[model samples]
Target: MSRRYHRKSRQFMIGDTLTIPQDKPDIEFLLRMTAVPTIDKATGADKKVIFSGHVLVTIEYVACVPDGTQPIHFVSFEQPFTGAISHRSARPDRSIHLKGLMEVQELQLVGPRQVKTSLQLKVCSVKLVRCRSPLPTHAGEA
Candidate 1:
């Protein structure tokens, strides 16, 4: 038996604060930022589907310096997140497939050595039923 079903996408917000190393210079200004989200596991229970994942965030910025010349620096970190969605056909026996899209909604510098970021994740769930067919005993038999 095989069946397909589509449910409304679920959205979640993840926030994190990063502290720069003591040896590194203070952040002067941000140049660029990027975030990538990955789904580690998905499970169904009762009438809901749950998922857990992590996001990799990288930031490029200019470091404060005594000289007028500007120096560029980069910092990267991972943030873990978890969320759940309600569905009519969700069950522990059913397999779930998840597709996710992530966006960096907000980025702010809390201080000279701290950075804050807010990320939004949108997840779409697909339920799949796998069927196994028995093989014939003889090659000629159908």
Candidate 2:
């Protein structure tokens, strides 16, 4: 009689290493980091859904300058991730909607020229089913 829906959420971790160019100034400290996730593909199976996508990570840091001034620099990179979510209502015939959220969990400096970043991606899935009801025979039929 009523519409039915199923929901599931999954979390994934993505890690990447970035190397600074020789022409760029040395990194003095990190200022801020952000990430954005994009879903590339999604597939629905018997009772599970598989997804693959990439996250764009941006890093802003203060670079050491010879002029005794702190200069801000930015670097961006893309990292790929894949994950799956299982739901009892998930099926090839039903429709599934996906939402993604990403956060920069950790950042570490491996060396003067390299940096390691850890990102957490949260994916939410909702399965929708169409509800059908019999039409009334007459306008006032109860």
TM-score for candidate 2 = 0.76
Residue pair clashes in candidate 1: none
lDDT of 2 by residue, 1-142 (tens): 4232334878778897888778778888888877777777666778888878777777888998889789899988888888989877776665556667764368888877788988877877744353243222111000
After superposition, candidate 2 runs with Cα above 4 Å error: 1-6, 21-23, 127-142
Worst 10 residues of 2 by lDDT: 133-142
Candidate 1 residue-wise lDDT, 38-108, digit = tens: 77787778888888877778889899999967799998888898889887777887677766677435789
Cand. 1 TM to true fold: 0.78
> What is every candidate's alpha-carbon RMSD to the true fold?
9.9, 10.8
Kindly give the number of clashing pairs for every candidate: 0, 0
Every model's TM-score? 0.78, 0.76
